[model samples]
Target: MTSPDDSLQLTATELRMATFRLARRLRCARAADSMSDAQLAVLADLRMNGRRTISTLAERERVTAPSMTNTINGLEEQGYVTRAVDEDDRRRVQVEITDAGAELVVETIRRRDVLLADMLADLDFTEDELTTLREASVLMRRVTDR
Candidate 1:
């Protein structure tokens, strides 16, 4: 018999795989054709967290500072983001999403939700299964909240 700890590890692995797959599929539903997934991810983070320094965003995104800088450069060129001297600390530059970037994030989320809903409908899952999924989402959020 599998130990309880082994079973727990198996469940965690399955959860991680399922979450990764769903996120990968949703990533295909972006509103901006010019934006790479990483760029949009940083944009969305900005929209959620407000202004942040490149180094901070880099750490949160698990990327090198230069990579984050490149991502921000792309976003800046497209007018999706702007960089300015931090008022509190002029030595540091902060990045914030432009109104256009926020709109893009909203639209992309809308598209992803629609696609996900349609996919779920096609599954024709029982009510209990759908409820379980909804409950699982809440649990997932709880587990991931930082």
Candidate 2:
């Protein structure tokens, strides 16, 4: 005897929680030398998009300029990223991921993929069930992107 609005609210809550748990599980499957999540996030972005300015990264990561700088500093200390003056504009500084950073990201991804693959395999889901899960993942991504 629940109203439609209440049912929708419950569904939304469930979806949010499910996604959060899954993300947390993946995050936990990192390498022993994995950097902080913030640092990793910045490195991952740089890896994907080449070099980026501090302001660009700050905006993209929804963080303050100082916060991004601190994150960048930590990454620099670990040799995961390097900052250099922009050749096109000496006034600007650009950050780029080093080879070590790229390797760490790849290794972390492999670990997470292995963890997920093993767990999913253990579940022994039927083909239809796996297909449904894949479709649901796509739908959830669409929901997020919107």
Please give the CA lDDT of all the candidate structures. Answer: 0.93, 0.89
Among all candidates shown, the one with the greatest lDDT:
1
lDDT value, candidate 2, whole model: 0.89
Best prediction by TM-score = 1
Q: lDDT tens string, model 2, 1-146? A: 99999999999999989888988988888764557787778888998999999999999889999999999998888888999999999999999999999998888889999999888999999999999999998998899766
Off by over 4 Å in 1: none
| Candidate 2 local Cα displacement, residue 5, angstroms | 3.5
| Poorest 10 consecutive residues by lDDT, candidate 1 | 32-41
TM agreement with the true structure for every prediction: 0.92, 0.89
* TM-score, candidate number 2: 0.89
